[model samples]
Target: MKVVKIGGSVFKKENIINLAEFIVKNYEPYKTIIVVSALGRSPYPYSTDELINLFVEFKQNHSNGNNYLLDLSKSFVVSCGENIAAGLLSFAINYLNPEFKAIPLNAFQANIITTDNPIDSDIITIEIDNILRLLENKFTPVICGFQGVSKSGKLTILKRGGTDITAAFITKLMKANEIHIIKDVDGLKSAPPNIIPHCITIEKCNIDELAEATMNGNPVVNPEAINILQETNAKIIIKSIFSEKFTLSSKEIVPTQLVSNISNKDNITKFVIYLPSQMKNKTLVLDKVLKEIFENSISLDFINLDVFNNLASFIVNNNQVEKIKQILDNNQLHYKTMGRLSKVSIIGYNMRGKPGIMYRINKALLNEKISIIQAQDSHISISLLVPLKYLATTIKALHQEFFEDY
Candidate 1:
């Protein structure tokens, strides 16, 4: 059996029928399961974001504090995108290739059981009985992606880009022979191609390496889904929707390059807290600040500490800028902010014990007239914080030094 996941970008009028043809022609031999995402960008009535606009307008006049009714309603509407796609694809397949039957299955019929969270859900279990029965009957099951039902029978939705999770879960539990994720791009690249045109396609990589390398911002694979598949033997094959070439995920991966990929997170707000030199117990005070941030549930990244200078700093998404200020002000902690910042990161396991990588990074940025604001590293990754204006130049410079030769 083969499980193929079609991305939302391939759902436009220009290509959908072609996609159906490709699926039918390429996957006709296998007992297949097709998972579908919401239609592409908005203005189209059935697109996921447009569906959410329905709830957003309703919530404006009938505002209620966070509650199940509001969340449940939003989940139902957004989940409709996948539902529509599933039905449409099933119909398309049946029309295009009459000999091969394609059946659409909703969350209940597909038995996608998830936790009680309505807006952002996690899959708890998948009963293969129904999907298996369909395959045995010479039918292909087109299951709605990014949605499941809670034990209480409430409609629930997964995080955005979660269709990847749905495909992996089905393939793993169903013990299917292959999992193919269809995207419009040419496999995975070291960086966003638009930003760094010279970026090379990554032919193969370990799941952990990909996740660490992408920690700056890319999220090439759904993190939770990657975690679920990390222990399994299944290989995730990412291919362009209409092409045969692909990037494969492997388990026993060895480092292939000094640096495998580079990615950047833009519009980051960095907060730096410096303790008074005369203040006693500086370590204790720094600990308190960190504890408060954690208790308040403010997620941060790229943390740096200078014990001798009694300074600590970290970056958070721009959306949380206000929350950070509130926490700092209420706690009476003095701090400074670097707004409109970006963090460029290089990720690779082969970098450990290697010399000149950091020197090369600094030289590259210096030559491009890009100043590094702050820097941090782990065994496999190096994150350099710089002004947002210099982001493009930083990525290009680093890519040239590390990947152009590679």
Candidate 2:
């Protein structure tokens, strides 16, 4: 079995026909399922954002302005885009192969059950027997992504990039042999091709490396989707829909491993806010502080809260420091600042049980007389906070130690 997700960017009329032909030609032997996203950037009347905006305007102008009604209405309205795309693709497939059957299925029909968050719902249960029945009868099930039905039967939409999540969930549920995410780009690149000179395309990477890149603002794929893939045995192929000579082969994500030289040099500022150690209700204070910070449109990074010392430290961009300071001052919080710091991370999926990885990283940086202010590690990544002056050196030294051909 195979699950293929066609991205919104490549859901044009001609592209849909081409995709149908490609699947019929190559995947005839397998039970294939197609997932489609809304049409992208075309002069379409019902893009997701436009649908939401239209619903809000209509509600404000015509309805009683109830919040529940607004959310419910928005969910139903925005889902139309995916439904249209799915229906169109199913039609194209059936047209191309008259002997083959293609069926368009919405979330309700496919049994994608979720929580009632309306805008960004969490999938609770997905009944797959109906999908299996379709495949058994030699039908191609074209599913509308990014939309699902709540337990209470209310229409709910997943977060933006939810189609990727939908595909991953289905792939895991069905234990599909492979997943192909058709997108506009060639594949994941080492860096943004337009910004970084001579950036190379990454042909293979584990889920950890992909997640690290996604978290560091690389828009190759959805982080949530990658999280789902981490639990499955399926290998994902991220390829361009424009490519005619692409292979179905994929780079599998190995467990407890990491790949090196993945670095983000963006300047970030670290703030350590001190709370009164004797103060009760620390949770309340922390929540209020964080709420204010988020309201200012400032995103916190590398956050660490030490409840024992009542110290909360986090990093933010230089541009958000002044606003953060004003919020702290207004709340009468005492804090210390560390500016001009850069985050260097070595990411891999196999770094979890491995020994001496940190020791080697420390030795490389120490040899250069670079001071490491702070370090954070996950199962797949070890991130260091160093001075901006050592950013390039740190990346080069770590890359040489971990990724260089020896």
Q: Per-candidate TM vs. native? A: 0.92, 0.75
Which residue pairs in candidate 1 have backbone atoms (N, alpha carbon, C) closer than 3 angstroms, thus clashing? none
State the lDDT of candidate 1 residue by residue for 262-376, as single tens digits.
8778889999997778888888877787798898878889787887887888999999899889888977779999899988889887888888888889999989888788888
Which residue runs of candidate 1 sit more than 4 Å off their true CA positions? 28-30, 62-66, 278-285
- Per-residue CA lDDT of model 2 for 182-252, tens digit only, reads 88776765444554444445566665577676776566677788788778878777787566423222346
Lowest lDDT block of 10, candidate 2? 244-253
Give candidate 2 misplaced runs (Cα > 4 Å): 42-44, 59-63, 244-270, 276-300, 305-311, 316-332, 336-379, 382-406
Clashes of 1: 0
Q: Weakest 10 consecutive residues, lDDT, candidate 1?
A: 213-222
Model 2 quality (TM-score): 0.75
